[model samples]
Target: MASKHDIPLTGSSVNIVKKCGPALNDILNSKFGCGATFSGVDFERDLSIAHQKSSYVGPDRRFGVTLHSGVEVSVWKADLTNLSVDAVVNAANTDLQHVGGLAWALSKAGGPQIQRDSDDHIRKNGPLLTGEAIISAPGKLPCKNIIHAVGPQLTDPSYISSAEPFLEKAINSILDRVKTNKLNTVAIPAISSGLFNYPLPQCANTIVKTVKRYYEGVFFNIGHIPKEILLVNHDDLTVQEMERACREILAPHLAVPNSQTTARKTRSAAKTSTPTVQIANVCLTLMKGRIEDQPTDVIVNTASPDLKLSTGEISKALLQKAGPEIQNAIKNTPPKGYVIRTPSYKLPCKEVYHTRCTDRGAHGAEKVLWKSVSDCLWLTAASFYKSIAFPAIGTGNLKFTRKESARILLDAVNQFAQNSTQKMNVYFVIFPSDHGTFQAFEEQMKWLQAPRGPTPEASEKRDPFPNTRTPPPQISLTGPSIESLFEADKWLGHLFKSSGTIEIYNNFIQHFSHNDYVQLSRLQQNGVSVEEFFTAGHACITLNGPSDEVAVAALQVEAMLCSVQKDFVAEEEGEMLLLSSAGNNVPFERKRVDRSTQEFKDKAAAFHKQGLRISKLDKVENSTLQLLFNLKKNQLQCHATEEMFQRVPAQFCEMVSHVGFHAEFAPPEDPAYGEGIYFASTAKKAMEVWKGKREEYLYFVEAEVLTGSSVPGRRGLFLPPALGTEPLRVHDSVSGGSDISVIFSGYQALPKYIITCQK
Candidate 1:
């Protein structure tokens, strides 16, 4: 190690001396940006010791996005050791040896405890795979915990293909630790970007993307996670890359204009070669290419019984291309029936429809396949997407023949195309390497054109009606001769009007229990043909009539289908509710304050300066007071009752910890603000936000909330609406009427401390 005297008085070192008087000797002695050691000071040290006691970062940016729950995701150029978060993530290898790079720096600062705990952990659990992670107790470091995650190395073969998945695993493992341990904030370096030989930009992108993806799940799932995620790095390049990635991947959306979203062809694709045919209003096309690369509104990915995307070759490929973010999305919001819908990460498509057809036996195999394929189409239409690309599903590990699977799957598509009263482009994409599957699908596509029902020419030829005169049937009606002629003429008209038949497969079974029979009877009374049948273990509903009547009936049937789906989702939510309320269900940390510490005096002063007398500060670590622990956290909030501010992102906070989403996203009784949870920028504002109708009984929640870009708000708005008349961008939040801010999503805010005070 370099001697203390060898250190230079650089900008940060010089500033340290100026801010902290009479610490010249200590400031000149310590090394800065050295990965092997960190002073592990609190974030407030931004104002404190350098002997120059500098925190891990050099000034760069918090360039990040605040999620729905008030979680702040920031990227900074700083040393990892300087951060005083609840936990710091260490990029480690399999053996738990802290020999070099970030591992050495963290181990050095944290002292021998890290090594000892790591060795013991590895000794008991064995070596970790590239994506696996383990947690270690902090030794001498300022943070309370450490998470050790293994990332991929360039030395491994086909690391490109393997790296994304492994890297994602490593990132997720770290996040999982944060969630399980209930760490309010976690600092993570770019894993694999050091000596592991992973490319810096890709490594940073994957990490940022995974973090964003994880938060997305938190928003959807109401899962408990850290309030803040810090992407801390000592070097400028890595930090820059991290910032770039966060900006690109987590950039907030602007209100988009209503523009046509047409499917664009890949540069390499030959438009003339794709086999296509029209079925009613839909264009059925067969293309041989990678399903993940198709630029469609939605693409299909086959999953296993567990609904994990990594279990099959096709799904594994999609997951790899999509990165681990997809996995995070999958685990948080499980599949309802045969399919789970997630926003696609790295894939070209907008959404990935993960379908499971795990019935290995022949008995119910076709039924499941029908459900999987039909579900994808049904969801595609429901989302109002004009196009969807599906992979050849029946063939791979499920072991069905290419021909049989193609025919069965396409049969579902053919059925959907005929029934849907909307314009759609349906694509069956075969993997480029799988020539046989392409041939099977291609042949089936031609057969789809051959005839699903009798054509006009074929019908005329079969009946000999157009070319030859039909023999007049003897009409025996108790009326005049004209009546007999009319009855004879009406017989031909019945044969001439063709029935528009639509067949639906794999009912959710519960639909029958809920007005489906009554609804079907209503259709019959309205002159729409309806039939219900059972195949394998599932129920089927078919509707037939004139095109317009069938179309109308189709709308009602779609509603029933949606109701059936609601049952599965609603059931899952009920289970989550039960799991959210007990011990360890929601994670918050509390430690009694040491009122004797000098730091407490300073924080108390900061608090008193805000025009409020603290009856008490319930919890404190030594002398410091911090309300934001990562959830783009602010200091603290004072609850209000009966006042205008009493209503927060009204009900959003109530739905924390799988404590999922509020029906209206506004404050409890006030939806006038933007549709999001509320946060205040200052201590005074925080006090105002939570100050209740009464003063004696007071409650405050210290939280990390990410309130990024904001604009003024009005009541009754659900999400941050578009900011301008021309741009497609929407504000991340709205400045609340109560001198506060409101964010739409729950994931952006993480509740850290709950302090009760008496006035």
Candidate 2:
């Protein structure tokens, strides 16, 4: 709690706040119930200042950029009536009645003349159809003219199917109005996305892409006429989406395809964008999306102390997807702590954690928030969950400002990253409509990523490795003070040592001679690898070599997880270098890459990016390049295992050893942990699970199981659950409490010793 209250804004944070203008002076003189303080170990005050700095972008806060075609596209969250554009586009219904949503607000600002003009247009032209538009003179509004465009209503199920095409037409109609009136500037809201039930991302993409394409003369004759077109919305989420759409659509070496071709274009892209910030092995990200769609191991919600989902949009959506079991569980359970955990019955995620704050900003809201967030993260990591997604949930009543809540959420993650040593992916998902909170988080991330001068060694220049496009992003927060930072560099020297060596690699990272960026998590397998976390953010992963060397070559082992789910994914990162047990000749650079086909060149280039050797001698003729590679199979041996199971059919008792299903006497398949080999914490627990009248030679293997990112072990499961966000990658193993450790794949575990007992 002390850590939650008296928090310091690192040396870099202090440097940032000292530069704030009058806001600094105002905070210094201001008086409040809790008393705010910035850069003076006050989390709340520093957060407020951060919000102010992020929100204020000069006098007008114009978030705009000029395109290559000299068309200035400005996207910002603001009142349309306040912006003095030549023409403003209104998202109107068929009858053009400005009664609800943004339409009413615009009409209220413009007075009764707008309604009268709309009525006149409808009477003269008989109710305007969807995708149609009618122009009207500005009546007390800031803009010179108004383009009342009829956008498709997405809420209607019958019209939902035709919404996209109609929405496109509506945008084109607005642009046509611009051309007809020769308007130099226009502001358009995200049509059909308000109460009309259209999605924000699609709405934004459609509008921005259409505008860009229209300017490029993709649409009949609607070429770039207006010097500036503003994609203004009242909410920051929509504005941010527009900005993102603009960047992605206009990036260099980029081509945006229509909806029909989107599938093909998206599939070719291998990697998505990186997290906002990466600390040690933890990646903290901010996503603008619905929590229900977030693919994480756990979905965290701020709930009542009794563990009930509130009647909010996010909660309703999740409840609807998960069925009524969650609500039913709440009725049966007693009052819990700040946090409670539940299994996701029908939801995409494995589990759900709910926390309570009750009061957000009244008094000591920071402590309550800190506990909720910290506990959720700690619990998730403890359960070996890889990822967790959190929505902007707060004080039972949604009375707190988005900025306050945003700051608290980020602060919690920051604290966790500072102290955590686990490799975790944490996502703070904001619904696309909450702009203020999104911007707050975006600003905090920018400040957090600021270079804190942790290591002066980062300033040094290093020789570039061959064939790597860019170096992997890894920073030494505390420099390489440990003696065993890169143990892989010294492995060759210790290979032939005929004894069990006790070499310690605090951080087992392999630096590829060809490319320093290529990281190999596992060098070998068979020994124990311990994991620990402290206040200092550092994670240690150790690997032990195979036992075929007649001596213990390595103490720690990094196990390679095998899964049937990853059939489509490549087994290795790229062209893997095989290490043979027997001494063999190093591969010679003699093989020439065939240059006749473009396909061969593309394959060679792709392999080159993954640090595969491709040498071209200066004196070589015919533009020949030599490739040095000798890929061999890496296999693991399975030891004899024995276990008991309930009486069942022979097919159910059958086991898979290495290749496929065989009639081998392996451990019985247990669905409690995905039908895998279950290991008890002790022999007593093993006996309790599988004891029978004929149990005499009772035993279990004390193997080094690779529990990468596990989910709860439930009945009827065949394989380990898929990794959070990656449906193709399954968890290395499944876990079930203090009694059992379920190894889904034989390759994921190595039998170290056997515990035999007689009952």
Candidate 3:
């Protein structure tokens, strides 16, 4: 049996391997892989001892010991060092190629050897199961080893749903490896945000909460392992947001080191005979100096106001207090003024300059404040030509929003360079948890790389939806029925564009099934027919007999369906139109399912239990649709299964093939299942409507035959009975005695508000 120390404080230990039981040889290999190269007896006990010694001695808390001191208790305010660790955990997927993210940066720093070793190991081991760990040498890194832990696969339960579990596994595995290796320090970056699709703030909370919990009570179980944990700071929005959240969550325990000794030494070492001047406000200091001769260095004094208080409020007050320091620096300068030459901050020879600024109120004002500060910095630069990089002007106590500050600063720098002879490269000298500011700065820089402008030679570019390969599908029909449907919101866009139906289906299962929301889709691809798509489930439809018997018959049919209803909701129209409008003026109300209502809440719960789904019609405007399914095998949800997809009917298949979608679904295997498939068509609009929702207007599809006989639009499936389904399909040609009626039904609406796809 596993020892008690192996259990994390969160409850049970994570399942490291999902598919296979370890054999004797497997154990031997694992031991060898662990590099138990030491020549000695009593290996097991020795290893256990070593593991115990390396575990972190996190902050004391009711929740439990944590992986890092501040990660759990939020006791520290500084960014943790990255190089000081036995191993660094890189949150990675099955494919380990370093793209644009923290993974990519780590890969770059670690060098090609790291990637080579990773690829080789993965080749030998295949894809890593969620919560599994594999160790390899750290290559160029300062750390001895790098433990690549695959969190959760983004295939099912969506990345969001599986995020917490994956994080739990990652935290435990890291702790276990740290203990076994007898390493005292470990650095970890924010996991699961980029491409993994988990929300930033939630991911942060999970990491901090889980690691803290692990360090608390669980350490004793691990033979009283005492260690240090460092949560490496990141330069991204995710990390900044995490820091903010962590600060709030860890408020009770947050404490500042009495750095009197350190500060005194720092001050003494850099001692200048000149008098030390301090400021209590950034705005007053920045405004103190003449715009023409701003101080070269703006020092922000973070000293407390001689009172006992919390860290957050103190950090917040620091920048404001530093403003007077800038004014003093300016006053102490020689009588001779620095030559002010340009609008940009760069001057002739003086290298760096710093200034204080503030975050007074809303984001709009902050932008303008930072811009002016940068303007002065540029003027200083122009006076000196080439100056050293300086800390940002207002980020300290002014409390300027990071994103806005970065944008304003970068913009000012760019504008100053327009005509100035002196150019200055600026650095923000950002404090810890300023990743959001860095991200904004980086984004602005990246945007500068692209060419700007429009031209007559760009006629091909005039069309917004260019036909690169197969253009995204479009719906040509007009009128009421085309206006209603639900698109699965922003997060699921990648899933819909995925190459194959199975992949899309799997993605949906992973992302939405565990959540309260419904995952809706229109056509399988750009051109796939609705019939082929609907055939995947057992679709039940209710009809309202002739108009003469409409009320009674419709009521009877609805009652019958209601009796068998395990979970459901009523809707007046199809969601296809809503899907199409997602890119345009898609009405918001019809698109989103109101979760506050008891009916929706109940239906949501029912959808979870029945292995089925529900679509309701409260009031039909001009159209409606509904469906019920028995999801026998969640193929799209589970790991690859041997079960085959049920072969659809011949006619349906023919229709699908005729209006075929251009798509692919090649699994990364010998006989790859389904991977990459693209469907092309002008019929995409119909597909969009099929998967979306329509609230404001009716979507209608009118048709006329060769004899000029006009028929009512059949697309308004959600219309009210008062509109009369018969009137929807009526023929304009006054024939001798032909009676016409339209086929209409209610729809199952998906949540539109939460998942709207931005145009």
Candidate 4:
């Protein structure tokens, strides 16, 4: 219902009279219904003529406001093409053709150059897909560049719900380009509202909301985003609609207080004297410093699967202090999601427990984080260590946010404390530089200290230690029996059963050590002294008796093995049990060895030593030739013209060729003679020629020839037959008039077996 006159004009609005002068007052009044009286002029006709001759030069200012994130957003009723900004957005079709209302206007004002560039882009990359955008140099427009954003066509009823996401994509694509190109300001049209028929209000809401969210989300990373985002439209009605949408949608978000301020206020209001959780025999303390400096009974090191001890700052520092012995002990160990104990060495702590934790953003990162912490506690408890220090496991280079890392870590420690019978002191050691991490832990501590109500029955049932020695009433594992394990009592019983524990350990070792000698060596090196069972089928090992050095070494070895096993399982599955002793100290390094060339050399030498004439041919030509070597018959047959037979060696010229060589000769010393010679033999013998040296053999031909020319002629071996030991029937015409023939048989280069044959 609001008219142009009703809209409030800001102080920046350009006065029409100031621009047009007194002569055009009568003309403006007649055309735009303005009724302003001049001091002394009644020249209405002259004013009308003057107004017709003049044109407006500047932007049509409407309304603008600065959002809470310090981004300037404006609603302007003016031609977008005329606005001088870094770029202007065009609501475009997926084809990127400038055919619609705004698109056509932009194309016209910008000249044919814009359309030509868009057409060229379409030709090269096909049509631009929906919810995507591309930039083009503005032709004659005031803006430097034009961003063509493709939104979903709302013509289909099914696409209604998807409009918001499409609009969001369009807005984000433009913003991304702006940031990438370091553009300061941009003007965007009311996208998808005209012939696209998207409702104006919804479109406006989407645009404003998307912009506000972008600024708010990236506020921390980029202090200054786009300096100004102008929502421009030539139509007055569209401008008014956008302004209204901005007030209703964006204003609320701006008015709300920042989240950090809100959190502080909430904490102050909930302040209390009593602690949030009070356990029987455990204490939780937060300390800020290097984990190595913490004087706990043991410290947990966040490590990778390779056990290189060179990833995070904490890891590097620990490794430097722990010395090379710790690295050497655990180098062969696989890194599973379990704790590995190693000697603290020069460290302040008595021992070190290492575990691999994933990035916070990865799948099941929370579960893995919890398991790492829990395993460390369980190992500490079993080893009879009263205190353990834990560094923020995944918070370092793993990119786990401080808040999430703290929450998961604290929850794990709290759960462990609630059920442990022995008194334990848990220290959360944080780096001095990570203030946010320290604050997160501090907040958690405050929350834990706040007074709470009675403990829930569900939580009480989750005891860290349940009686594991008691046997089940019977040993039946049928459907009902298996289903019964889901029950609380039965499940607890199943966890403690000696048979179950052994089965789990067997399975764990079998799966981890199968075909993996490194992991097997790690397990064997870290001798399994005693297996400590826990709730939920979790188990860890300790030294056979009470030797600290042996215990630390074993734990480190097992932890390394577990890490490697996890990586191998992620790759593929097999069941080849290969166990090796960790004490062997033989480093297993895998390298690629090519033996094909060597195999060829050995084969060539053997042929020579056995007194066979090796005639290296550079070229051979024949047609309708048949060379058949029958392995079962132990004979060679040839069918060819007399000229072809005469051209070949007299030893192989007979109609029925013999298996043995006609002349005695040593292996050829020249490289040319060595490479091209082929030995006539059975398929079985030929296949075995390169058995252990297949990779080094370079000769391409491996087929059993049935017909046609097999030799490469006097020039050289043109191309070895197909690269396989399988017998094949080959028939082809040759350019030469003469036809040559030889018995078909498997061939091998002598170099493959020269060393072995000579020995």
Candidate 5:
């Protein structure tokens, strides 16, 4: 019989009972005088209630899998201090401060005594190095003891080179404590990920692997094993990552029925060689050498899901030879299970296909590997690449056995060749150090070539002496282009000297006006060359220069036209004296001419009498007056222009000039849309906008036709071209449609009229 007080306080309390059933009962009865009896009913009833309350369960009771050494591992998303295990491991800094993440939370929940014990240990031991751990009594936590483990600070560049070994040592030290104390159950959190900066996936894989190895007696003496190990984390992301790691590394070993028998079979199979057989129009060859040294069209580099190249062996060799550009390219693209192509740099191959097949866990390992190999084959065939080579994808850091890796790779290649229409030569290149893997592949190849069935199509076309001749050195015309170099190194501003050209035309208005020619002259003075031509109601302007120079020239021309239009409006309303002094000063030098005629003096005096004061005036041409003025009553005036009007209103031809230009550099978009149009104050901003739009549309400049026959009232209205006139056509590769035209709605009214066509 059991009293209500003894019926386990919570789920954690029930876990304690389940973990140390008889031992816990005896301790409680003797120490606290809470007499509790245990039976199948009592255990089940209490466990069910505790589960309903908090959902905590012991590892052995939770996951029904047994390790080789009979130890069971489970993952739980729960607070470390609340777990009712023999001990909980804390990822502690060398100084052992309860500062952040798991360490901080554990200290707060477990009371100050945990910290006090840690202080005492630190005082005696100086400071704990990575891979060292000390055990202290758990003050208020449910666990019996706390293992403060110092793991490497992976964020530190110096420690990154030795992160794995240090991580392994930390796990081993914790296990050492557990074995010495003969504890049955323990809970651990992901070490070094919070402030230490170890990557979550790598941390998860390393921890699971280290623990698995420990349980298998790789680190400890035989017959010493903890009954249950719980990989616990309070954070959702960390828990998910650990769960995946366990599934991939531990679950496979536990789930496999008759794993020992399977191992024995695999070992026996590796001892014997298999004959090779051809499946389709593809021949598979295995050779032992450095993959980077192979003369193939492309070589495959096994990368992590993040496309992080490994630090050792073939991957390291590839990275060293390929330079940093390859890594940068990989980062710009999407990672995961996709295949990426990059220049091989100094490698023997023309290109390298970087693919990710690691960390896929046990169940998805085969599927991920197949997709990687299949994608490589398909891409090679589509590109007409004759030969491609592969390394043992997951057999290295991922811990997949060589035998299984060979089988999966060979099967994928075989299946692809059978269905794909293109023919290719596939080679499996292995390094000399990987002799076991090489033997495994050799055996599989031998078995495949065994004559058990009718001769296959691939066999008929196979070269009799395939290994005798080396592939001829491929002629590589694929050196780094200047465009690629510019893309790679944008900070090299001198590279902007490269130039391109585009031509623009408009059928509505023919010929460049005096103002248009003046603007073009100004551009030529500033490094841009603008060629203008006109014939029978159609005008064209060809602009060529460095990208920045062209952009600046176009912007200045737009500003000048806009200034002219404003002046025309002011002159027509008899408000020409209202031009602001702050408006754009003419870029070209202006010459002043004395106006002494009696009629001009009379008109000027009359304008002054009407409360208008012309602050400054200059002659634009023979009869034109460029005036800067303001109202006497108030300073109501625009600031982006200082020039006023042309003398003859009807002769003020609203000339539409179609202008085209190209830039070598692509600029980012401007946050301010119309920043530089009025004053050319935002030249950088205008260039950004131009380049951003250039990505999608072909650009043109169109000036409205203000002819002698135009009606004064309909000056700025939208007017179509003559009925029989042909529409101007501009060819643009960026836009999809062939005959898409973008009209400038208010070309006459706007200071700058920029026309764009879809294609």
Candidate 6:
């Protein structure tokens, strides 16, 4: 047992004070009775605290070191940063700029200056040795300084031995500098996990433990000096897996304190409400009990989708309890199906709906479970039913973690029950054998047992509309025609903003290049500050103009209007409202068009008049688009995708054309990095194309190093700003823009009836 008098530092800052080295160690060890053992050095005589205020470290103290005499341990604490700090540890090789793990990413993100800085440092320091530390400029990083902490160099025979300790030393050296410079935050990439073959989990554990040990005593005082560390991981899975592991690791530390021991024990006892599950033969013994006699609706936890109407299976034990008729019905039914005998002799209610939980192990089953639960609740409520019984779902199937499943079911039930004004009760039935399930229920009951927050009636009784004291006032907006174009831009912008790659369907997006803008003078002349002109809620229709002409005009003016609207959004910031297109849905092709039809003939005649004659149109409509496209020499035939065909009617067919423009954004390259020669030209082209388009279309930019390039034999990726009729082809043969068809914007915007010679 440790004595209270012997403990110098008692709060959360213990580990933090220990990482700063001798100064913090001596005072804490002496005062706290911590018998820390320092390797090779006599810490008792050498250690001294430079600054001590009742063992309270300031929040601005980003790093610290302390020793605990009681435990005989030395700990180091340093703040981790989200942004770059004094030194960002890099996993680098002698050839620093070349592709590897952290090195490649750092090089890419930092731009070309990083390589230059690295080269300059190496020239002065010679080649860096494993465990060696040096300082350099951050290049393009947010940090002003860069601490190049080298790990062991890899060779054929693994240099694993020197790698581990070097990592530790590198970290220590950085922390040492942090204290010296009084710098607060630093971001750390998972060093040596890539190409070098360091195990990720082990590396993660080491980094976390080192940070934990160092900052044991000093974290609370680190003001703007971030004590919080954000681990940057490129891999999404790696981040999630590591996060889950960390959560589990921290769980033991956050366990309930002893103050609630007695209460916990009581709750634990209450949790064991059910006894062992007993299986008995099918039999029904009904006693006299009115339907209204039951206190509330009984909800059985189930693993099936349909609960209310489906005749779900019942246990042999339950069958014996329910007797012959119910038992017979249950035996023949599928699992989780519910059979309600209205006005039962044993309980209250006009009907009984049986439901089940979803099976955890069932592949592709969670969606089914969610859908089933929602369906049952919705169906039951449709009949104006007040309450129903439900069971613990997923307990038997183990589909969900106990606490998680309990919360989900209870939330769903509570939400459903509240949609009615009548009284509602959700009775959770527990089986004797399911101890874990029972524990979850008991835990929920505590919150359920509370006197409800703010309003108890809302908690106990269902109310269709809790805040129904006053009717919601109506709101409306009216704006100039410019607002309609703003809506179109917003709608298209959202579609393009979608995650992953976006592809435009059919000739709808291809036919027109829209540049929607109100002239700067027109905007001011109209007395519209761009706010009133582009407000989202305002529905502006071209009341007297031709719909097609108006739409085309809106498309052309959208960019200028969006630019204006964006400024307003920035100015208003918090006050901006949402705007959606009234009736326009994404136009997707629904059916394959007959290329030989009158419409096709008319289009062919129009194009022929323009000197762009089709050679062939593919009869088959493959891929997602039901488009009928034909190749003309330097010209292209365009049609709608399946989605567009289905969404847009034939009346809107005129909206489909052979010309349009779209744009994409990317990070501009640094000249200092020496144009990644192989990819530079393509990237330039891509930038040009993206900047030129403002309408709906599929666009792509790829940079690749082609064979036999004049600049260097070295390889690099290339970017080609190209438009495609479909998703970008990943096949290597089509390197860069080989597979993409670059539709000429100027040519697409040309009128269809202009006959001219092919120059």
TM-score of every model? Answer: 0.28, 0.31, 0.32, 0.27, 0.27, 0.31
Candidate 2, residues 512-621, lDDT tens digits: the string is 11111111221222242323222111123333333222122121121111111111122221121222232222221212234555644553464345333222101111
Preferred candidate (lDDT higher): 1 or 5: 1
| Ranking 3 against 4 by TM-score, winner | 3
Model 6 C-alpha lDDT per residue in residues 1-759, reported as the tens digit of each score: 121111122221222222222332222222121222112111111111111111211122212222221111111122222244555666666434424345544555566777787777777768766656566666676666666666553333255555667666655555555556565545555555654455666656655555455555455543333333434443322343344434444334444543385355764465543321100100111112222233443323242343322233333233333345543443355542333322222334444444444466776444445444544554443333445545555545444777655655554444433222122333455544566666665554344323243322335422223443422111111111222223323443332232322222221221121111212222223222222221211122121133222222232233223233333323322221111121222232223234677755764564455344532221221211111121111233232211100111111212121111111111112212111211223222333322323422211211112222122111122422223443452211112233222221211221111111111
Name the candidate that leads on TM-score.
3
RMSD per candidate (Å) reads: 33.1, 28.0, 26.8, 33.5, 30.6, 26.7
* Residue 30 displacement (Å), model 3: 47
For residue 579, what is the lDDT in candidate 6?
A: 17
CA lDDT of 596 in candidate 5? 73
TM-score of 6: 0.31
How many residue pairs of model 6 clash at the backbone?
A: 112
Top-scoring candidate (lDDT): 1
Q: Per-residue CA lDDT of candidate 1, range 98-142, in tens? A: 755677677778878888888788789898887988887889888
Task: Say which prediction, candidate 3 or candidate 6, comes out ahead on lDDT.
Answer: 6
Could you tell me the lDDT of residue 651 within candidate 3? Answer: 14
What is the lDDT of every predicted structure here?
0.59, 0.52, 0.34, 0.51, 0.53, 0.35
Summarize candidate 5's per-residue lDDT along 1-759 as a digit string, tens digits.
Answer: 111211212323333333333233222222222223332212211111100122223332224356878888888767676788899999988877764456766776788888788888879889898799988898898999999999887535555657899999999999899888888988888888765678777889999999988887573465568898888875445665787788788886544443364355664454442223334446577766788888899999887656666554767789887777778877786643458888788888988998776553666666777778878886676455778999988788777778777767876786566444334678887775566887777655644544343322334423222343432211111111222222212211212222434333322113234324533565575467887665322245666876555533433333333334444444433432223333223222223223475644643464355343322223222111122221311222222322111111111211211111101011112212111111111222223233432222222222111111111111122232322354543111110022111122211111122222222
TM-score of 2: 0.31
Stretches of model 5 off by over 4 angstroms after superposition: 1-64, 156-161, 217-220, 253-759
Residue 325 displacement (Å), model 5: 67
- Candidate 3 on 291-327: residue-level lDDT in tens? 2133333222221222111233322333234333433
